[model samples]
Target: MTSRAAQEEGVQFGLADTGNSIPVGLVTGIAAAALAAGAALVWWMRRRRTTRG
Candidate 1:
């Protein structure tokens, strides 16, 4: 019974790891785009605030 439990646990762990495998390139691209967009938005907001004030 213990052996069967261990086998089931291992299979579940393996699948969990593989199921979450995201490509590094895609992750990096997403991060870069988000950063650029955030920076641009902040810059625009500050510019507008300064102009109005």
Candidate 2:
């Protein structure tokens, strides 16, 4: 770990544990939406297969 001054001087890169830039709320919403979409697609595929058979 280096001081902020050193980082600013471009002596080190990505060596610090800088906090996440993305908001937790936004991440949670995106994950939830993806899960719901995936579930709906799976359900639709199963229904279509059953009807055709």
Candidate 3:
């Protein structure tokens, strides 16, 4: 009975790990893209303002 319980727990952990990996990867990807875009926008605005002034 203990072995059966251990097997069940292992399966649950494996499933959780598999399910979480993709969304974690996707969130990181989105965050990186957003940061890059924000930096680019700031740089462009600064350049434009400098030229105008």
Clashes per candidate (backbone, < 3 Å): 0, 0, 0
Rank list by lDDT:
2, 1, 3
By lDDT, who's the top model here? 2
Relative to the true structure, how large is the alpha-carbon lDDT of every model? Answer: 0.83, 0.88, 0.82
Candidate 2 wrong stretches, greater than 4 Å: 1-19
The weakest ten consecutive residues by lDDT in model 2 span 10-19
Residue 12 displacement (Å), model 3: 17
The predictions' CA RMSDs to the true structure, in order, are 3.4, 4.2, 5.0
The sequence of per-residue lDDT tens digits that candidate 2 reaches over residues 32-52 is 999999999999999999999
Model 1 regions lying over 4 Å from their true place: 1-5, 8-15, 18-20
Q: Write the per-residue lDDT of candidate 3 for residues 1-53, one digit (tens) a residue.
A: 47679788774333434455467878889999999999999999999999999
Higher-ranked by TM-score: 2 or 3: 2
Q: lDDT by residue for model 1 over 1-53, one digit each (tens)?
A: 47679788774433444535788899899999999999999999999999999
